[model samples]
Target: MTAADGSRLYGSDASTADQREALLSGEVPVAVYGLGKMGLPLAAVYADVTGDVVGADVDEGVVEAVNAGECHVESEPGLSELVERTVAAGAFEATADPRAAAERAAIHVVIVPTPITDEKEADLSALESVARDVGAELDTGDAVFVECTVPPRTCADLLEPMLAEEAGHDAFGLAFCPERTASGRALADIRGAYPKVVGGVDDESTRVAELVYGELTDNDVLAVGDATTAECVKVFEGLYRDVNIALANELATFADEIGVDVNEAIETANTQPFCDLHDPGPGVGGHCIPYYPYFVINGFETEAPLLRTAREVNDSMPAFTVNTLAREVRAEGGDLADATVAILGLTYRPGVEETRATPAGPIAEELAAAGAEVVAVDPLLDDADEFVAEMIPQRALYDPDRDLDAVVLVTPHEAFDDIEWERFDPLVVVDGRQYLDLSDTDHRVYTVGSGVTSAGRAESAEPHRDANLAAEVER
Candidate 1:
């Protein structure tokens, strides 16, 4: 069969075996819109599986790079090699024109940005723009899949009607197949590190989605009730992390007052099958966790008190980290107002280059505002001109004559594991991630969710007796 003949699966009379065969051959062409980090990996995997796919991006540089057999996205394990192989084998190519790619494909997948506005409303501008392009050349039997996360009901309430209007008819299939992937492990996540979730506007859309992803992934395909449910699956996953991390952070704040190691307690409590608590950190960074809560809090009229409180708690952590540093400096007979502090690891995570809502920005700003001179060091990021603190290379950060009064371990990259703590004079150290083992050093240390250490000794903490032992002794 030619590329167009018997390739359409939306309303085809072909058998399931025949449809899968057609998709595996070069007959059923696929177009993936928005070739960003997640999008590129998705497109490459589609090309590898389907043998005919086009990646669409508005950025000319990205298109040129992909067309020339190069991957612009970094830190993904096998994406670079996959893109090169797919492009060289004629199984994949990229284009700046979405309309052209849509015209030749039986399936169009969109994974564009859905950023929030300044007022914290879900911005669907990029998604809508790509939807219009897909609709302009939309065929009757073609199917559209949305793999990006948005507020729930976006597919049913907004995208379906908009696509129908633009296409001048509603014969096409539409589904919400959210991208359940992470930045550093996109390929594994896409190719079935987890079960694929698919929901649709109608039965045919759901069937088509199940068929497509069933072939693409090695894991099982979960067909939900509708598109909104699939959207919620993605958003709710992030929201759960946000709330859990907030609880961990709130508990961490009580370590000093309660005189117990909250991190250790959390780790011990999680041994029970019923309990699963996340680690406490300086703040919730990364794009997914920080913004997903707002989708629920502001998307609907219903009040989300728990989500709002979680956001407030997580947002307050950066300031809390700074305050902890200031108090530690005072205990060390040094004033933050006359100190030069250094922030290590500016990115949200250790190895990834992304920094959408990283806590380092606020930490630096608060430290500088309190009259402390701040310098930041990150191995991944090349540009720090926008940071409130001076940007120093990682090599220069450990210079003996650097004149640093305090240090905060923010991201805890692997490069910091071998640092010689005795190279410099004693300074106040705040372990924001619970990553440092500086208890043996001369530096005074304060670990979040753990108590303080001074010159290889823990500060005096009030001890509590076990309830069972206390009752037995009193009897």
Candidate 2:
């Protein structure tokens, strides 16, 4: 397929209309690298639009599953069906060989992981490996889009030259069109939950990206100045959340000291439109928020006091949660060292199995160090082997023989809402996410940002006799 036949869109004299038609008609074959959580949905969407796409992954199992039209990634609403449909229609396929996919494809999209090292620096090894594979067989007029989140200057300084060197020429198009999709709603986000952002190393690259994504997404494609700007857009979005949550966590720490309910104050203050405070919880979990600040702070030589401070504040929250649990247990005439504490919901977010940088890990460690017997309840995970707690099903947590001195709700999973708070005897309950409403119960509830709510003594209250029996259990 030649440029004259409308097969190549980048660096071509073809009109925008012709380029759009070529992209949608599958004349400009697309190859997507990294078929993980974000990448699979992206490849499926590209296939759905272009009718010709190939996804490449290093994991043999992942490639095999995709080749069999099965999605290994879970919790994505419509990804499995999309993958099956695309593969069955011969519009999309998966391969273990990246070189084979790159050789025939005119458009390359890289959505590999850019995780942080233990030293808090951006780890682009995965991205670099994928880029080298794509670049090895990249044609003169081919287009490459980096949709993974990375440091601002990563594409402009690193990948651009790296890919050019591997390709032995600088005739290709390179752009950064970072994925703005979340975990559970990948299909909606990819199809058009938000406007797509596109920026290239040069003008032609930007134009090519705009044309391709314009058809892929229902929303507008925002063409920015350069690739670095697009990278900054994604990183800045996460940094804003990290810093904002840090501010909220700092304010929540003052709830008891200031003798006022900060949650109520924050909720009321946010009604003024200028204020957009995030909720303070046990800590900020999930892979994105906790690691994005480092992409800026460590990537540059400039001193970012605010970013560093935010990181410190957010990191301290897990320990603060454990300390609060200890203090509250003491107030209830029980020692944390001798108490049986149960941690509810181990996953970072409610229903997903993504535990990367989850606060539950640190919370469990702290509870163990303090000599508390920690038992975890999470239906999403089969076992708590990674955590320092005894893994127990949600139903077994309410057994009459098992007495819990305290409970910390690290993640406010919808499953936890069905918990029978009255089953347990009057105990210390630290609502880490402030999701519990134990005002009417005998248990003393201490919400993260709210002061302790007294639930009166059980002077004449009878023990819950049918706590285990005659009730429907759900997780």
Candidate 3:
């Protein structure tokens, strides 16, 4: 396709103006496979931009939900309205048949999950299945792009050959453009907020993919050398953040050992022009930060010592939080074996309901395994069952009138800022995320990485709970 400025956007032998004109004229459709969190919003954005969009997924419930103008994923905002408008405009529809979706579109986008196997290997089963489905309806000039986060060379070395074998073609136009959208801000990010990176098997394929994304966003579209480079870009971006977080956690631990205030140290350090450090937390979680680095190391068979060590350091944080809680319980003269430990926050991070790779999961499991009566609560999760089932939702957590030994703050949800500190009567509060201010509170508060102490009753200062001293302790 050629632009009005006489610049040829695609390679010389690529699809001509006829295809572009057909697309703009609502003749050439766009299809998106795997209508999950990323895929559904991407399909909605495309439907909003163009008049023809088809969404396909393996889950019939998801397809039906979208078709009925509803969103099953809580991360998406105003998704129901978008789906209703698109469906009413006759520009968007969802189905379970991948082949049908592929046949109806000239450009196909795959946003399926590339999860890791039990052995920590790159599991390409979902990507391979979608490629086979797309190949079944692959035409000579059809353009295909993978928007999923994958390991280096995954698109060029693994997916390309798979698509070729399935489609019975020697070559096809294909590219890899990793998604950089956040969970809550996906709609805006996908629309035009961030730059788009396009890398393809050939110049023609790169151009085709760039033109496709260019139509959606006005942001800068960069064309890298090949799919391998594009894939590495995303991995590096995520792994770098993970390593930095690990550093923050390690420093926080040292601050606790030295009886220094970590928050003050981090604040002072951040004032320097060259320093851009993140805060320490209970643990690293979320779909991207915790898992993306492993994909690179596992797929490429390279020794990423720092990256692997960073993952381990972050992963070990929950256990450390648990151990800290146990120690505090003992210091408070309370035996954790029979104490009721209330956990605040279950989602991975704040302000969103996605719980994939949430650190709270491991923290809760470890707390329960340690023989504590773990009563978990989060403003996002409605009930204990739902919290145990989905681990995240929009409803507030239930607060029962029961005495507690300690409360662990894992996620710093905004709503938690409003909670009354007096509710946990005489409870020890362990601020894992540093979400609380305990300066004025009479209760004992222990913060991770912040070695601050508070005045406690004599019974609490002992090594175990003394029922005799409880009568003397003021509520």
Candidate 4:
């Protein structure tokens, strides 16, 4: 078969249907490109299926780890053992060369990162680079599937033409299969939980792509209209999340002004069964939520007014957090210029080491830029001071003798839930994520979008007096 660009899309012997049947009968050669969080776990799944799985990555360390029967990315139970067994059986291997891997495999799954530029433009350099590499070595009948979050037209607009031009085919069998695997539970979700979305450049492409994914996942695969629609499905899923988070953030702010607890109200609202509301926090973070919408808006020239507004609201959260902390500092009779502020939580969210698009990084950088001596802490972060230089470990949040102007809780890590607020001699708490209980604390505590007052009798009288005066003046 050939693609529109006159390239041999797939070889006569490389049948996706045959591969699928072989996968069911336990005989398929699958190569997964990019060994980051998503690709590594996917490779492990194919490994478990006893299929010939080639894990390819540009990073030599990751490739070496996979070849040594070690999993580079953290995943669910039994992944290490599966990788080890697969390596021992010669069923799995890792390589840095894409062409070599492509030559040896009947199915290629591209899982490269599709991040956005500072101007909110889709940086398809990495994806394009991979496409060029794959195109140079693609054979007829070999199926190539893209499983990254991208704009609706990316696969058809960029990938199809690139592959066709590189391989000299008219219409190659190509498909877009967006992955819905959650970060932490990727191993389980990839194997069974989330259903797959498969869309092809044409009908034959769709069938072959479905066959490839069906072997690894037990969940149902829904075939969409075409590649563009499949691409939209991924972006829509993420944009939907961004919009809901913005709504929650906006409502949380309103709830604070009206003396209503947003969390409690959301709980009540969720009882209706149809109104499922996501919780608001310091802001939306992570790779997909923060970056994917920009691609959708930019790629399609679609007027996503609400989505655009939501992006603004979420992006502005860091500055808002810093401003809120500044107010708390002022309440303690201290200005940011001379105050030493301690920030709690550095990771974007809880329980993950991923810092991509993490709001805490920008928040800390902004605070430093505003002349505040910022000290950051996160339980998951070891050697935190070195990782970002401005951050410190949770245990070293404050020097006992040096009075802290404020402690900003940016991430709601469970460990922070039990902290004794009395430790800081003169502390003003800003709960950015609404994670802490300020009801019993003696320190004056303020939360993002929530007006929860603290009940604390401070040992230092002068600061408390100034704080009360500032509170009165602001009202």
In candidate 4, stretches whose alpha carbon ends up further than 4 angstroms from where it belongs are 1-19, 24-27, 75-77, 384-387, 390-402, 456-475
Which digits, one per residue and each the tens of the lDDT, describe model 4 over residues 27-121? 44677888888888888887677447787899999999999999876634666787888788877899998778876666678999988987888
Error of 4 at 125 (Å): 1.2
| Local accuracy of candidate 3 as per-residue lDDT tens digits, 297-411 | 7766568899888887898788777776776777767877777887788778787886778888887777777787777777776545554654322223546466667888988
The backbone clash count of each candidate, in order, is: 0, 0, 2, 20
* lDDT minimum window of 10 residues, candidate 4: 1-10
Q: Tell me, what's the RMSD of every candidate?
A: 5.8, 6.9, 6.1, 5.3
Model 3 RMSD in angstroms: 6.1
Error of 2 at 185 (Å): 0.6
Using alpha carbons, what is the TM-score of model 1? 0.94
Report how far off residue 346 is in candidate 3 (Å).
0.8
The CA lDDT of each predicted structure is 0.87, 0.85, 0.76, 0.74
| Cα lDDT tens digits for candidate 1, 61-149 | 99999999999999999999999999999999999999899888889999999888899888889999999999988888889999999
Q: Estimate candidate 2's alpha-carbon lDDT, on a 0 to 1 scale.
A: 0.85
Better of 3 and 4 by TM-score: 3
